[model samples]
Target: MTYDPTFDQTRLDQLADQCLADNTGTGKVIFLSDDEDNRLELTSWRFEDEEAKARLMKSDFKLYLLELLDTLLVYRAQHKQPNASRGVVSVCKNQMTVQWVSRAEAERLRDL
Candidate 1:
């Protein structure tokens, strides 16, 4: 997972597309509820000040999140075990943590 705060607005959309493709071959999807993004949303409101722009930016963030959620669903589906364990491809807030989900899958994705 690469994290660059300097990314342009299209970054989230690109992530979304990747998720859609990855999930198609992966597994079943269940969308979890949103968490404490309200505070983050408020902070965003403080930064942009304009509701319209903030709403658009917020939507983009959600699109990326939905993509990630779908990817999780697909990856879980590939597992043979019925008892599912939740995992995440999360980049820490400090952007320093990376826990590889699968070595083979990572390698395969890298080849692409």
Candidate 2:
């Protein structure tokens, strides 16, 4: 599958907006996709006053995230290394980062 730069940028923008709306303060959201099991795990943290911190529920943003993930999967399937078992997406404000993880790395993250 060819990479769709336009689709990816749009979905990523939407995801960033969703995160900003859901978080009351500076926040970071991490999404982990387990390709082997077809699962997506989300972890979100909100920081306030450099002291107060809380984990935010990501249910409301799942749809947007899934859309982004689906697009990424298509692109990844065509280009990723065989050993890559997980896709990691990290978002903060309007910035986003994506990377592939090995099965062992995915498991280690899940344990944390």
Q: TM-scores of the models, in the given order?
A: 0.27, 0.53
Superposed by TM-score, candidate 1 places the C-alpha of residue 53 at a distance from the truth, in angstroms, of: 15
Clash counts for the predictions, in order: 1, 0
For TM-score, the strongest prediction is 2
Which parts of model 1 have CA positions greater than 4 angstroms off?
A: 1-59, 81-112
What tens-digit string does per-residue lDDT give for candidate 2 at 42-107?
433323423312333435454566656755654555565353235456555445556566767655
Local lDDT at 112 for model 1: 43
User: Scored by CA lDDT, what does every candidate get?
Assistant: 0.32, 0.51
Question: Against the true structure, whose lDDT is highest?
Answer: 2
Model 1 over residues 4-93: C-alpha lDDT tens digits? 323322443456454333221211111222222211110111121344333434555445554544443334344432211222233222
